[model samples]
Target: MNSWVNASKFFTGASTVGSIAIPAILKHAGIIGWGALAMELSSFFIFVIAIMCYMSMYDEDGYSSMI
Candidate 1:
């Protein structure tokens, strides 16, 4: 369970980084619009907020699952 959770966290971190980086890469390559970037930024913040909420549902010892 711990391994799976850790792997999920790792992938989430990677995806968060990619969410920032891939947009920039696409814009630089002229494949996306400004509106698309704006949408991505908004969605990323929402994703972060959801992650924070999920984390806060657990206690410091990380034993409680209440999300």
Candidate 2:
């Protein structure tokens, strides 16, 4: 009967921890999703910044030149 009591205690502890952790796991995944999106958008912004810099540097006597 002691073994049964120990087994019950173990499962009860595991269930309690699992109940607390499931929502935390989902929240972590959601945060990672947004982090990935932010990383992608930052890369896109870097490309845009590079293009603007290149364009501004290519002006010829206030005249626009196409590359």
Candidate 3:
């Protein structure tokens, strides 16, 4: 299908281009140093918070359209 093909292309492009930048960003942020574990845990918490915020938009009683 066209959607699958497009998704594959996008994933491939992102994997090739975006993957390299992660290491550079981590190094610059000292995430690869002594505080790596703490930084990783903090990042996980941030991701969870963002997910909670996003999911709150779909709360059943909060918004009729979102439900």
Highest lDDT: give the candidate number. Answer: 1
The local lDDT score (0 to 100) that residue 12 gets in candidate 1 is 84
Candidate 2 contains a number of clashing pairs equal to 0
RMSD after Cα superposition, model 2: 22.9
Please give the lDDT score for candidate 3. 0.71
Which candidate model has the greater lDDT, 1 or 3?
Answer: 1
lDDT of 2: 0.70
Higher-TM-score candidate among 1 and 2? 1
lDDT of 1 at 49: 96
Error of 3 at 16 (Å): 1.3
Off by over 4 Å in 1: 1-12, 60-67
How does each model score on TM-score? 0.62, 0.43, 0.43
Clashing pairs in 2: none
- TM-score between candidate 3 and the true structure: 0.43
Output the number of the TM-score-best candidate. 1
Badly placed stretches (over 4 Å) of model 2 are 31-67
lDDT order of candidates, top first? 1, 3, 2
Writing each residue's lDDT as its tens digit, candidate 2 over 11-66 gives: 98897566546545655778546555556556656876998999998868664544
